[model samples]
Target chain A: MSAPAKLPRWAELGLLPAVNLVAALLLSGVIIRLIGESPWAALKLLADGAFGSQEAVGYTLYYATNFIFTGLAVAVAYHAGLFNIGAEGQAYIGGLGTGLVCLWLGAWPFWVVLPLAILAGAVGGAAWAFIPGWLQARRGSHIVITTIMFNFIASAVMTWLLVNILIKPGQQSPESREFAANAFMPGLHTLLGKVGLAFTATPLNLAFLLALAASFLVWLLVWRTRWGYALRVAGQNPAAAVYAGILPPRVTIAAMLLSGALAGSLGLNELMGAQHRILLDFPGGAGFVGIAVALMGRNHPVGIFLAAVLFGALMQGGSQLSFDMPRVNRDMVVVIQGLVILFCGALENVARVPLAALLARLRGEKEAE
Target chain B: METYTLIVLLLAATIRVATPLLLAALAGLFSERSGVIALGLEGMMLGAAFAAAAASAVTGSVWLGLGAGIATAVALALLLAFAGVTHRGNQVVAGMAVNIMVAGLGPALALAWFNLGGQTPQLEGAGQRFLALTWPWADAARAAPFPGLLYAELLSGHNLVVYFAAALVPFSAWVLYRTRFGLRLRAVGENPSAVDTAGISVTRLRYQAVMISGVLCGVAGTYLSTAASAGFVRDMTAGKGYLALAALIFGKWRPYPTLGACLLFAFTDALATRLQGVALPLVGVIPVQFILALPYVLTVLLLAGFVGTAVAPKAIGAPYAKEK
Candidate 1:
């Protein structure tokens, strides 16, 4: 594969993302115009709904909390040179784990159950991902194909478990009963109010704090630890890593396991914190969205966090836009999100060409002078 | 139902369900054999399915519907070619982006055009929807017994699209292996630099491969909208493109084997459809989801090399770059 053109730090991190964002928004505007919607009105509505009030901001972060887990999951694997597209499946299984634990240990004290839920979530996600990792490392299966297949398997398993086994008697909906009291995550508003800061109630919960810790943990693992260095080394070049006495297969498994664990934590936010019940299709495409987040953020922990927030705003705001402008439906918001991903993930080079050329020209002129 | 009748029904259902997978796998075969991965086949198929349904509803012509579908898919194929061959972006990432883009665009456009919850108006009459072609004496089944009855009921009543999908397998196999273009195409995937040194345009070959892929996917989409059911629904492909990819890998990217894998997967699906709520000999009742998941689980097993090693094209995901 060709190495992406290396530009200055500002150009790489700042200029390119800015240019791509503008292009994506411009294209989205064109599509909106074609659909006969007022693009400007939609934009204003989106902004207001995302950030106009504390409650709105709280909801946005609530969504961001899930993205953060999936994004970090993606970024971790990305640094290790794995695509990890199975994050969606991993997260589903992870939620199943948490949901089961929450149901089984409903009567346990909060302190007794919380750690168990965390471990189950991590173990569940990691278990789902481990097969693909083992296959790629040991059996020569391509990670992309296997992981993609596992996603379907994961969906089927979740469907069967929820619809057939877990549904309450006489309940027609394919959902588990409301979770036990100990499983209820304290919402952000409540937690903040405990300290005296007035915050409105929203779905945002202590999981957001967990997400913050996860970001720091990712940063620490990727930048500050030897294990992370070996993993990154393995990704960059298997031959080089082997020469340096690193075991490539072991690194692959470790990276995938960690990535899956991070992704699985989404269950904690969406299930334990928000829905408080096992429901159908809870992952809701967040796992795939993580790919966009990772790509836009350049697979950095801080970058992933910011990108997650930006996407969270988009989702929260887009819903408001759809609500206010009847013409702009839910699909319209998806189109916008997809456009952003297309530009940022695949079409970034279109914007990069001119920017890189300009920067090279500037460098040449300075050297010549 | 009698045992014989159930067996016949399952076999018939298998062929019906296998058509889409066969078409999509063939489409993916073309793209992957020419050195490009096609994860975006899902998007292309979905776009075309929508276009075919919407156009047929408006035009009252199934042929025109099929044409619209192909055109839509070809346009997407061109975009993928642009991203992979020209821009040289990451292949899988570009594909995933295209998939997400179309997933959004299909329902959004459907909502705008039809206001029917991302579903097109049902294809209105005999002309708009492809009708099943019953062979002569197929209707004689009521008066006949055993062989003639089974033959008529099982073989005579599929839409013409199913036959076309089945025929394309051998056609693709011949075009992929027995033709001169096939020779060069195979070479390009393996060693584009060799083709480049031999003075063939690598980009053009890859583009051509992707175009064929698009047409095949378009046909698959048309069949979904016009033949399988009537009209387009959101996410109608339902990861069939990915399933086809799994089949391709299981087949080791070969056309004939690809057909076999598709058939196996389709059979499992047909079985799953029939198995739902049925009491088993040992287990009280099988969970339908587990049976529905059988294809993916099997695919994962095949991919993990449990069955055999699946070898892909050597330079499949790599962009063509001249050595400096």
Candidate 2:
């Protein structure tokens, strides 16, 4: 066996996030240069578009609301060593549930309808994910293959439901009718203005506050709860966890269910707060972006929240960038996100080797001599 | 039609449906057998489709287009192998990166190269298409009512690569079970350290397997763009490569069973397409999405219920490193 070396405190606690941010910026800069755009100009445009005005800040926060939930979903599963790749499908199912509830209970008050709709969404999301989770936990099937396959199945099912069943007749698009006014989240634009705190025209809502609350709850569960500790232990070493009498299959299943529920909450927020109806591609790419967020954050809740905000800014700014730099496609944002995930995942393995720390100590000793 | 005719028709549909999947599954077999999990097969197929369309448009030779597709896939496989085998990078992460890169790059390049947006210019005339095969005896059997070109066309009349895909089943089975090189390949997947100690180079063997997978994926991509369809469209392969990987697992990593799994999925897809117009009682009310979802739902069910004890090759996704 190899000797166990003491890890430096800073490397273990702080260096990773800083390194990821630096790597993300460098890669984004390189991508900008490759596309023949000036990096400084792009950065300035992004800053202005994301936070230049109170309206911009509100919009960024609005986008961050959905991402925050999805990021937590991914982090929860990662902590249990279950890669929940079916978040996209689960989110779709959640949106469907939210829509159906709104249609059925359109006369209900906002106080009652909203909570019931969100709960229904969570249940739908959990049910959608349970199939793959049960398969993996009970039969030892690979979660990756099952979840990937489920995404396609869910897409087809959702499309069919939208077109044939849920669609209001004569509408060609895959979408439902407008949601009841009671189902809508109270927009912060009017409320904040009434309170003399409004500085923007954007419509932030209760979902943003819920997103922050969800992140804090996740942080608490992961760092303090016994179940979370067991999940982490199982993730870190399944064989050892099994030896210690922890049922890995059960933990994996629970983690995946929770992940799906969180993803479902994102769909609820989008349906009730932003769009007020289910539309095709409503939660577009947020599920996939959550993967990058989880990776960039090193699967930590606080880290995922920060990463989600960064991406939310990029996405919100990317739309404005289209108007300013008409030649550059907004897809450059996707490329940047992909590069960050790639580098961050790769860096995780490299960082554990202590080569950088060893070199730093050696240089300091040489200087002393 | 009589029961015999119905049976024959079903058999024919199965073979035709299985062709692309069979080719892709064979590709998966090669990569996984070499201890590398190729999650990038979807990306490789997409790249090959684009390249084949561009080459065929420029050269006016379908054969040249086929070659271009294979070459492109092989180049991608080399990249995957380099990161996975040589640099000892995380195989899944590298594979995913390659996929994202291709998804982004393919459309961007198509826009720049073809100027047709996300599609290629369609090919014209029978000269650029695959010809069907016919049999004299089958034609003469009116009592038996054997399908003339239909029988041979379903089984053998495919483009050269379709035949190659069928041949790969028996050929791969033979190579894997009978050959010395196959033994070393299996050894490397099962125990790289043991193989390294036994004087075999793990890197070289793995590189060869991954390259072979690349070539096969390239052929599959060409078949999609040129043989199956007249032109390439954006994201034409969709998720077929991933489905083939699922088939690989469903087949329990065996050649024959994997081919069977491919046929099963393809048959369901063909059935779904054929059922689009029919309105048969209560089931007719079922949405097209339900039918389309059949294959994947069945795959999940089968994996969860029936294939209870499948085992992957040892060290399947682990990158091999030399000891200091």
Best by lDDT, which number?
A: 1
Question: Candidate 2, what DockQ?
Answer: 0.37
Report the Cα lDDT for residue B72, model 2.
93
Q: How much is the lDDT of residue A333 in candidate 1?
A: 64
Against the reference, the lDDT scores of all candidates come to 0.88, 0.77
> In model 2, which residue pairs have backbone atoms overlapping below 3 Å?
none
Which segments of candidate 1 are over 4 A away from where they belong? A365-369
| Candidate 1: residue B278 lDDT (0-100) | 88
The C-alpha interface RMSD of every prediction is: 1.3, 3.3
- What does the lDDT read for residue A230 in candidate 2? 86
Specify the poorest-scoring 10-residue window by lDDT in model 1 chain A.
A1-10
**Candidate 1 residues B111-133, lDDT tens each?**
88788888899887778988889
Q: Which DockQ-derived CAPRI band holds candidate 1?
A: medium
**Candidate 2 A-chain TM-score:** 0.92
